[model samples]
Target: MSDEPERQIKALTGALMEVYETLRLICLHLPVPIQLPRGPEYDLNTLVPAVSRLIEIIGDQPMREDEQSLVWGSALNWTAAAKLYSRYLLTGGDFVSRLELELLIQTAGEGLIIYLDGPDSTTQE
Candidate 1:
């Protein structure tokens, strides 16, 4: 792995974590007046920007041969999740859309773990 790929992966991972945390907060703060650690301002403004950075990273980098499948699949999954999340917000948090968004984010997170930890680690688990 070259330094550039490593850099991109690290950046991607950070962006993914941000988006994931934002979504988690959105879900948690929906039904209750709970005080989240990050306060009560986690909304589309925050999510969309983080997601935009994530998409940019995914789009700008070419998938390396070593982890091509995982990267490609993750890219698709993240993009879908972002769109679904937008729909989820627009529809006033539909349960089905939320569920679907969760699934996509979960799958994308797993793919990211595989990419970061090395593909062989998947079999070891």
Candidate 2:
């Protein structure tokens, strides 16, 4: 494998870490009553596995454009979903809105896991 995929993984993981830090800041400001879950939908649950697989893929081969895009898109989704959840929580939303936030978190997590098993894999695995 070339250094290109290594470089790409570094860049992608850096962007992902920025998103993670931003979300952590958001969490710090969330209402005291609204503790984020340590459950399956936790951001790290999405981030850790994805980053691990990305590292493996970088070590094994180059990334296709579609795979790169999916990873980047998932980072954005994680950011958007977290922000929306935080905003809704801070604004005193209803239970239905809370449920919607849960769905957003879950969906963003699903998006992040698209490459969890490697370059040719899907979330279905």
Candidate 3:
């Protein structure tokens, strides 16, 4: 039998790399220089949110390929969640990251991606 876990890891890594590259390029354009009071220990926590904000922008921005325009509804795609979870493992302490990962898995399994905004036309700060 095939090793399902290994397969999942591979797929998720591929997707993450793709999304990460795209976001990394966008991060280069962030107007504000990020400054942290602490050190590398907080890099993951601080950088992750910055990246999350970029993800939101990416979801709204359209990509053009082969004369087609494609937009991501959210970064929480099923395969992407695995990458995020693995990141959470490496990032160390963070309860919010853990919850987001679980919710991503649950929603992805249901064939849906959750956005940062509420259904009632409000946004989350």
Write the residue-wise lDDT of candidate 3 on 2-112 in tens digits: 585455545544544444344344334334322212332323445456544544454343332211111132333433565566676566526576566556655543321
Best by lDDT: 1
Runs in model 1 lying further than 4 Å from the true structure? 1-66, 122-125
The CA lDDT at 19 in model 2 is 49
- What is the C-alpha lDDT profile of model 2 across 1-125, one tens digit per residue? 56854554354444445545443343334232112333324465555554344333432334455555554455456655445544654575555765565555555455445545455665355
Which of the two, 1 or 2, has more TM-score?
1
The 0-to-1 C-alpha lDDT of every candidate, in the order given, reads 0.55, 0.48, 0.42
Where is model 1 poorest over a 10-residue stretch in terms of lDDT? 27-36
lDDT of 1 by residue, 24-123 (tens): 4432432232222352454545555554444444334444554555554665676677666666555655556656776777787777677667658656
**Better-scoring candidate (TM-score), 2 or 3:** 2
Task: Give the 10-residue window scoring lowest on summed lDDT in candidate 2.
Answer: 31-40
- Clashing pairs for predicted structure model 2, backbone only: none
Per-candidate count of clashing residue pairs (backbone under 3 Å): 0, 0, 0
Model 3 Cα displacement at 58 (Å)?
Answer: 10
